[model samples]
Every structure is written in structure tokens, then in C-alpha cells.
Target: MVSKVKIKINDLYKIFGPKGESHVEKVKSGMGKPELLEKHSHVLGLQNINLDIIEGKIQVIMGLSGSGKSTLIRHINRLIEPTAGQIFIDDTDVLAMSDEELMNFRRFKASMVFQKFALLPHRTVLANTIYGLTMQGLEVKEAEERAAHWLKRVGLEGFEDRYPAQLSGGMQQRVGLARALATDADILLMDEAFSALDPLIRSDMQEILLELQEELHKTIVFITHDLDEALRIGDDIAILRDGRLVQQGSSQDIVLNPADDYVGDFIKDINRARVLTLGTLPLKKASTKGIALSNNTSLENAMKALVDAKKDSVIVVKGDKKLGSVSMHDIVHAATRSSETAGEAVTYR
Candidate 1:
């Protein structure tokens, strides 16, 4: 079943300068970021970005510093207005909204989670969590109820009375997440929300986000520079380079078939066994006589299952229906194959 697109971005461009609009023609005429800046004194922030973010899916926009990843996400909420383009939420033109309408949209329709936690230093966790709700003129009792629910959901039930300064970085970030989720907004704009945490804490936060997503199914726009994080959390990923979108696809598409050497370099060192799933690999017809693995099982887990069961192959199933079978040889080949040699069809024997 095709998922509906919740947010649509078309021909998006952002150039920073007094005469940004005048230089749009030159930018469209094939001028690069550096050339535009060095020649015309305008900093190119985003170039002709087009994307359709599906509803109830995590859409990750990733790029290194100055790649315009942060810039792109800010555009979604109109925190930063575009030089030229259109942003549509549920087919409503965001740019066409009146100032009051835009204000209401930001207040009720979308919520942001910042990398720095963005919690009020003086306010208690409970108070910070209800900040947005209070701004919306929600009744104090009702806002507190909603805030408490989300704080508990984020595992911060007991810490609501604690100030942001009392909490650790991870805990503070959790408060940020709770605050965002408490609003019950449909769209979540997370701008490097976990980047500052230690590795283990970051992983924990990722698990929490995934768990919450399974239930809430919000249209989440997560911005990150880390490829591993992007692969782990994103349902769809868009990679940008020097203000231009370089590639956009699922983890399988990016890992198995990178758009270019730049993208291939980003994925070359990644653990393919952990990222690629059974459903992504080409399968062969075989008897469903041995152990069965789900279509979504990772290649690493599938390999372990085969080894533990002492089987050469396992039938891949989706629910009660058998899809196909995968062999140990196929798993190894798919995991180790480089993107340069990746297009050859898999033939399990």
C-alpha cells in the first residue's frame, strides 16, 4: 500500500544576501555554491531541493556541516524562509499562509526538538514540557495532564520536578523530546536531536524514538550528519552536498547502490550485515522445509540463525506466507560486495 505524502518540498532554494532574488537566475544557470559566494557575494544555503516526505515515516535529511541539512529542516517550519520554492503540508501551501495562520500552524501542527535540548534553564521539567501547551491557551490542568503523560512516556516521570540544570545532557534531551511529543503535533522536526549525547546514550535515545514511532507514527523529519544514525532511524533518507541534494532513498538503495563516489565513500565502512535485511536481497525459490526467517530480519541475525540451526539455507517468510530462501553464501556475498561491483544479480545455489 502506498503511504500518503505528508509534506512536499518543490524547487526549494535559499540564498543569503541582500539581493538574493536577483541572483536566483545565475544560481539556476548552473552556478556552484563556491562560485556564487566568491563571485556574487551570496551564500547559497539550499539548491533546488525536491522531496515528498511520506506520512507517518521518519524522513532523514543528512549532510556534513555546511551541507545545508540544518538549513533544509528549518525551511519546513518556515523558521527560515526560502529564497524560492514551495512547501506543502497536507497539500496546503505553507508559503501562502497568512502570518496568523503560519503562527497557528507552528503552534499546533508541528513541533521541533533541538540539538541543544532547548529546555528552559529556570523551569522544572514539568513546566518546560507544558510550555507549548500553555502558549496554545490550553487549560492548565489539561496541559499538565498531557505533559505528565509524555514525560512518563519518555521515562522521566519522577524527574518532572527537577530543573534542566539538575539533569544530565541525555536527561535534558529526554525532556526536550517529551516537550515535543507532549504537544501531540503531527509533524516532528528533530534537528540533530541526539548528536550531542555520548554514544551509548545516543543509542538508547534512538531506541526510545523508534519505540515511540511504532505507536505514534508521526511524520518525523530528523536531521543528522551521521550515516549510521540515518540508516538506523530513517525510513527515507535524503543526502545533501554543498547545498544540493545528492541522493535520496532507503538504506538498502543507498548501501547496495550509491548514487555516486561521494555517497559510496560515506557507506563503504558501514556494517552491511547490520543494515541490509532479507527483504532487500534477491531470493531464490526453495522448499520451505527448514527454519524460517521473517522478511525484515537483518542479514547478521539471519546468518546467526542459520549457523545456530546448522542449516545451509532458511525460508524467508512474511507472516504465514513464504517469500523465498537465502543461503549462507548469498549472505556473505551480499554483505561483502562493494558498491562498484554491486549490480550483479544474486543467484542462490
Candidate 2:
């Protein structure tokens, strides 16, 4: 009963007009709802989006390009205004904030990391990390100490004197990560911060980010199109499609129980073995016995075990006692379910 909502995005919407300059006098005058207008003629850039990213949680906002993922992330920090809705960060109404309040919020409450690692190319790493503190008018010595601390935390300890152009993609992103962390903000809005790198570098960045999240526990609202990356970093995931929130839940739920055809199609080719758990697929309890497996193992993986064991089924165990089992038949049954088929997924704990 004590868990509180941290970041709440309530029924948000944003629209775009087909014409250049994107005029909407009716919306400005508060005479027309964006929904009705967009349905008939306007382009709905974002539609009735609702999300709650809890404090100290890593929530990934994932979708294909044009899925409104980026648009939704922008609303939290007022980088882009919503057409309608209320966004509250720590119960503070974001839209109602004055210029001073907004500035203070951005200065002390939220930090954003971009795909391009938006660093001042001319500035040294230490200088860039301290930029936000300088803007707040902190003493130069104090800011430098704080920046140095964060630089060390991000594994850029000796690179304080290096410029952005002197760093590699991963190294530059480390600087970006350092800058964001130096702000000591409670929330980090990352919009494809690692998407620009090669796969190897992206994996390294992901590990670095995971370590950072573990150390910082900042409520991160991340936007990404890569499914593996989403599964890697997200504690909860909200999927968007064509501006609407298609589904929101743990990554397990989305993979095992997709909300719609569109979502199913998206996950159709994913290696369910890597993404699912033994708890996701059910095993018929027999009249006699079963073999146990760690709750962490997936059915696709469990199937391999079943084959290797040459047994009728295998049990799911937490530590000692058996929780459940999966037979070869059960393995085939779960695996054979057409990724495109319309049916409810069976999950047993």
C-alpha cells in the first residue's frame, strides 16, 4: 500500500497538421479536441497515451520507427508540449509549472541523453560534465569535484582532459553518461542513446548503462526500437504503435502474451527461448513425479533439457522443491502455437 506513483502520463495527445507551419487555431483556442480533429483530418502524432514509470524502475518505451516512442519521452520533460493530458513527476503537475519551476525541474530533477551524445565538441570531458552545475552557478571548484566523481563512476577517470572528438563512440557516450549522471537528477530520459553505435559497442554501452542504473537507481524512461535492448534493460515496458499505447507490462508479458496481432507480428521471430521463462509455460501435474528447473529457465530452453534428460517432463524449482514440470508434448504444444495465432497464452507459476 505504500508504493507511490512516480511518473504518471495521463491520457496524453499530440497532433500534427499535414500543412507546413502546423497551424491549429482551434486547438490553441481550446475549441477542438485533438482526437476528433485528427481522426477526420489531422495527423495524430500521439494519441491518448497513458503510462506510469515507477520511481527507481527502468521502463522502456519500445516500438518501430514512427511509433510515437520519441514523442512520448519528450512530454515528460516538456521538451515537447502535449496536446492534452497531465504529466506528474513526483506528484508535481508538470504542465502547470512556471518558467522558473520548469527550469528548476530540468536543472535538478531530470536529465536527458540523446542518440547523438549531444556533447560540446569543443569542451573537455570534465568541462562538459560540469556544464549543468555551472549553469546553476555552483563554485567552479565544487563543480569540478562533482564532475570528476561522476567521470570516475562512468569509467572515464583519466579522460577528463580529452575532447569529444578525441573519444570513440563508446567513450563519447561514456562522457554523455557522465554528464547526465553528474546532474544528480532523479530521472533520466534516454532516447536511443546507444542506437547509433555498432552492435559490439552497443552491447558494451548497455552493460555500462545497466551498471549505472544499478548504482544510481534513477527512474529511467528509455526509448528504443531494438527488442533485445528493451528486454536487456527494461523492468517494465510500454509498447507504442501509431501513437497509441498498445500494451504495457513486464517484458515477459509482452513476449508471452502479446495484446494484438500487430504486437504478435512484432515478436513472431524473436527467440522465445531467450525471452521467456519456465513460469510462462504450463506442465500438467502427473499422478506420480517431476524434475525441477530454476524458475529463471525458459520453456524453449527447458525443452532442450527435456530432450537431453530423455524423460517425460522436467520440474521447475526455485531452490529445492519442485514447482512444475514440462513434458515433451508440453514443449511442442507451447512452441507450436503459431506466433500469428489468436489465443490466450497459458502461464503457470
Candidate 3:
């Protein structure tokens, strides 16, 4: 994890007020957000944000609206300068980079997908996708080849000649994705990229992103307000509240052990049976097994299989080898338990 870190943000802060800098010390001295705002008339957009974005993994920053999730992501590319902090990408000081250096970094090192599908309305899909490449002074022929390749990869093959208005909302977002991917940037900054799509379309886009990530391994920083979306797509999830990080860890860690009541309530409505996978369940020594199921199966599906087969327990297998066994009772109990509980374990084989 240490060696693979692609971006590190240290002691980041963003205060929105003319006198914001003066209030930094007050806020740091154990002042609550409400009190600070009331006394100083300043809004803290982010507070002491420290994060390690691992290479080739999705790091989701999620919270309700006004929680500073969006504010935190923009600091990566210096889209929104921080009041105080240091940002390092590949150990390069982003905050210290010159204008020309920042321009090159944005052109070649990072690409962004916005919630609004910020496509050029008049430009053809191919033209828009190739915009980044052309900015780098690549030849038109070479740029078109790369852009066309990514357009096809993102399922926009025949729509290359179509403008943004000619495409469906989902298709327009696909064009946006292709444009970002065409840049061949090491980091993908997706700010609620699929939130504007319909539910089914959003789900489809999520699957598409996951499929692409499996192959591309881009360092992704995804911003979302949806807990389900975060859990589904994020390899590491960071929860923010009132401009402060409440918790950060794997999805399983966050769900099984929420940092506080705020976080627990945030995930209270989540369907655990769907969110949890069999591999994350407690593993036990394989014993009397009625049916064998893959360790990667979802808890919901495993429960359904157990019910359909009239089995109390199922042996968990990875490949041909038995890994452990999990019982219907354990699954039910684990799924129903309050987030505050120290979750029960499934025995491992």
C-alpha cells in the first residue's frame, strides 16, 4: 500500500471567506463547525484532509450534499486551491508546480468526468474525444486513432460522427468517458459521473466503469452522494461530514464497523445481503457441507441458494479447493445486526 500510493494529500484545508486564513487557527483549536461559522462568518470547505489514493484502484469520496466530498476531489488537480495543505502526485508537489507545469500535468497526467457530461455540444464525438490529444500537439491521424479506439472501447463506435445533442443522456456520458480515457491519463477524476443518468442507465454505467477498471487499472477518484454507488464501485471509501473525514477504509470495514453514529445512520438503510460478498464473510473450517458455492458469490445469492436447496450450511470453495463453510443462520444474523455491534465471525477452513 505504501509503495503503490499514487497521490497523497496532507493536512488539507479550504476555508471560504475573506478572513478564512485568520480563522484556521481557531478552527484547529477544537472549534466546532457551527460555532466557527457563527462567530467568524466563514465556511470551512475541508478540514485537515489526509488521504492516500492507491495506484490502480477506485477511491470513492462520498457524503451527503454540502459535506465537502466535491471540494476534496478538486484539490487533487488544483481545480480548487486549498487554504493550507500539500498535494503530491507521484511524489511531485502539485501545489508548487508552475503554471506551465500545471498545464502539462492536467493535459497528460489527469482527466476529469463531470456530472453534467461536459461535452462540446457542437463537436462530433470523435472530435471531442480527440480534444485532449490535440492539445498535446499530437498529429491528427495519431490522435484520431487513439480517440477512435477509446470511443469504441466505451461503446460509442458508430456514433463518432454524432454531436452531443444527437445522443441519449447515457450515450453522451459514454462520450465523456471516452474523452477522458482517450487522454491516457494516469488518474481519472470522476465527480458524480453517472448521477445524472436514469437508475438502470446509472447501474449499467457503473458496471461499465468496473469492467473498464479491471482492464485499465486507472487510479480513480470517484465522488458520489450515493452510499450504494460508493460501496459498489470503490476499492477504498472515505466518508466526509461537515468538511471533516469521519472514516476511511474498505467497504466491508466501513459497513461492519462504522466510525460513529453518524456513519452508522448513513448506512442503516443499505441492503447488507446485496452489499456483502461471500469472500468477506467469516470463513470457517469446512465440515458438513450440503452444497458448495464460490467464495465470491454475494450474500443475497448465497442465502437464496441455501433456501432453494433446503440446506443449513454451504461449503465455500475457491477454484477446486474448499475454503470454509457458512450457515444460513450466520448470514441472517450478520445481515440483520446493528452497525454498532462487533459483527460475528464465520469459521474458516
State the C-alpha lDDT per candidate. 0.91, 0.82, 0.90
- Candidate 2 lDDT over 1-349, as tens digits, reads 4555789998787876544125344444443434545555776677667888888989999888878888889899999887777899988999999999999999999999898999999899999999888877789899999999989987899999999999998888888888888888999999999999899999988998898788788999999988889988899988888788899999889988899877786677676777788777774553344556787887677787777777767767778756666666766677666675545563211
For model 1, what is the C-alpha lDDT against the true structure?
A: 0.91
lDDT (10s digit) by residue, model 1, range 1-349: 7899999999999999998998888899999888998999999999999999999999999888888999999999999999999999999999999999998998899999999998899999999999989978899899999999999999998998999999999999999999999888999999999999999999999999999999999999999989999999999999998888999999888998888777777787789999999888888995766689999999999999888999988799999999998888999899877777345443211
Model 2 CA lDDT for position 265: 67
- Where model 1 places Cα greater than 4 Å from the true spot, the runs are 285-290, 318-323, 341-349
lDDT, model 2, position 345: 61
The positional error of residue 18 in candidate 3, measured at the CA in angstroms, is 2.1
- Which candidate leads in TM-score? 1
Tell me the deviation in Å of residue 257 in model 2.
1.6
Structural RMSD, model 1: 4.7
Q: How well does candidate 2 match the true structure in TM-score terms? A: 0.85
User: What lDDT would candidate 2 get against the real structure?
Assistant: 0.82
Provide the lDDT at 255 for model 2.
Answer: 87
Misplaced by over 4 Å in model 2 are: 17-42, 286-291, 300-312, 318-321, 332-338, 341-349
Off by over 4 Å in 3: 1-3, 279-286, 316-324, 338-349
Clashing pairs in 3: 282-346, 283-347, 283-348, 284-347, 284-348, 284-349, 285-348, 285-349
RMSD of each: 4.7, 5.5, 5.2
Give each model a TM-score.
0.93, 0.85, 0.91
